[model samples]
Target: MKKVIKIAGILFVLLLCAAYFLPAVQSYSHIPGEIYILKGSSKTIDLGLPVKADVDSSGVVNISGETLEKGALMQSPLVIKPLNYGKATIELSIFGIPVKTVRVNVTESLTVIPGGQSIGVALDTRGALVVGITGVQVSDGKVENPAREAGMLPGDVIIRANGIEIQNAKQLMKIINETQGTLALKLDRNGRTIDIFVNPVHDPSDGKMRLGVWVRDNTAGVGTLTFIIPDTRQYGGLGHAITDLDTGSVLSVREGEIYFSEVIQINKGESGIPGEIKGFFSNSSGHMGNIEKNTEFGIYGKVFDDVDLSAFGEPIQVASRDEIKTGPAQILSTVDNEGVKAFSCQILRLNDQREPEQKGIVLQITDKELLEKTGGIIQGMSGSPIIQNGKLVGAVTHVFVNDPSKGYGLYADFMLGMLD
Candidate 1:
């Protein structure tokens, strides 16, 4: 019995050791397929083993050692620094065994003037978005849902009405009100364009023609400006896409505008209840820019001459994900009418994202003023520029509902890639 017990204890110890070391080696084996490195920047990667850095293009990259050096440290991280602007491949090997191949893209030193001023985003959808369909009361007191009868469903985009292109909800309403009989609607249902016929009902309550469908053509909200490219006079904001309030679908933007805004109130955040920063758009000739694209990485467009970028100070070079570390950082956000202020934050987590994702970095608000006022990140704080080590690393995105102090951020590399 003593022998058996001793053997069991030995086996348990071996299993525990394997459990700790196996996953670490497995995770280390899984390096990013592609890594973006800015010119003259360095990235450190720990693979849990000695690695020989072999750069295909010597002109673009500089390895730590010679071609026949043993490797990076057995347990230490490998430091790969970019020397010039070009593409190269860094082959990492352990004792001549190729373990991983990283496509190193040494890009130009891209810089942007960080923006924190709150800008009112007024987006006009390409077509009216159908949110819901309900029964409409006619003159005879009969309730009818014409849109539903025509197979029209929520999430459908109405593009045309009575052979005319419908740009907004008001235009669709006007045609319906003036139509003598049945109306033809060209709709885009999940990208399948089709036409549907529905007869409008004259409501007794207001004597207006009704389709019994709730549709919206425009949306407006406030968000912090992320950056403005000096050479292009273009800017981007709201690291994540602008989703509809009802259906939660990404809105397809036709055209939009940015206006100057000021925060009026702040709803303190708590666990499970997200907070918001309410602001009013200024109609005082503060037209700042025009939005042209609405992508998963936010909105991008041209800026007007009236927009004052002097408040942003100087342009900062962007940082790739390879350069982001889990440590101290700061975010530029406008929580009030006082303009942009830098708030300290800590990067708690960094995700391995080969593709574009909004939650590339997780950060916690550590600024006393921001915490005291908003209780962490709030709505309208999206697009706040995240700076780390004097580089623009990302932009603030969604706040965690269970922890308002923590929120997601999009890597600046992803946002800058969308400019073209």
Candidate 2:
């Protein structure tokens, strides 16, 4: 009878240890390597473990929490309060065994006006983009591909030819058709520059000298504006970079513009299929802003004086990654001619990203009206502003192909960093 009681006690202790360690391991995996905190504010972090936290610099940040007993049923939550504008390190340990160290940065707070105005984007690439390479029928009935033979790929950007800068497809075509000898071309291939020489062939079909390459110089699309910094008159939009549909390469922007646009039609999304919003804009009169930079995070530029800012309301505080929570939120978007409207949504998950990244937050459309109208996040809504606790938190970036009602978002901090 005593042996049986001893065995049962051992089993109970083992079960307790399993309960404590399982959640600890899962929580440790989701902890970010670094986090940003606003000065004079505090951040609460729950790792779901009985762990102790220690800060390297007490002047920069204060860490307060209690480490529970081993195999304890309850876990303690740590509160990290930022005291000044500086950096600190917090080390977490379980029973005196160091597990993870997180770098903390306390910075000044920032504010911006959340934007949901539909805008048309027109981008002109730095150089002509090669879309295709074909054979040219020469006068002797022989076929030759000068572009392919010269080591030029379909995605290569022709920046210069014969020491002259090439701006567009028309300019490059004129130079190739009028050149007498082998032409020296400077190409930008995947961000690297290379020099190549190609001899133009005289095609019998059109009686013109040709390189047998199809190129494109510009692209146009519509997207929602994300935010505007009222102090600097700068704005950001399209929480992601624009890429070529044919080559799948990011277009190198030389100059671009954002114009006022109005949505005219909507193709609702469904399972296994994506949808889009059709909009129209005129470049001659509705010019609202000029694009200065196009990065993976978003596009940033200065808003024009002619733009109307009354509908955007007042500027709101921007939330850091640590401040975002998994709960109910709202998003501003324009699906029809009704202008911008706020819709209810839920933040399903938040990724603990140590560095700037896209798709940091998973969101689902919970608003019945929004779901009924556009069937969740569709095209032309890439930069719809996400609001939580009355603050601008992030922007919508991508929609899940398998589930159209769900989508991913980019943090507003990443977009704000690119404004400079």
Quantify all predictions' global Cα lDDT against the true fold.
0.85, 0.87
After superposition, candidate 2 runs with Cα above 4 Å error: 1-34, 44-59, 62-86, 94-96
Please report the TM-score between candidate 1 and the true structure.
0.81
In the range 1-420, model 2's lDDT, one tens digit per residue, is: 999999999999999998978777678767767888988777777777777666666677776632221212224576777778888887777777777788989988888999988899999999899988999888788999999999999999999999999889888989987899999999999989999999999987788889989899999999999999988889999999988889987898889999989898999999888889999988664898998888888888999887777657889999877778999999999999988999999999998776789999999999999999889999999999999999999999999988888999998988887877
Candidate that would win on TM-score? 2
Per-residue alpha-carbon lDDT of model 1 for 369-407, expressed as tens digits? 999999899888999999999999999999999989999
Give the 10-residue window scoring lowest on summed lDDT in candidate 2: 65-74
User: Each model's RMSD to truth, in Å?
Assistant: 5.6, 4.7
Clashing residue pairs in candidate 1 are none
Off by over 4 Å in 1: 1-33, 39-98
Count of clashing residue pairs in every prediction: 0, 0
lDDT of 2: 0.87
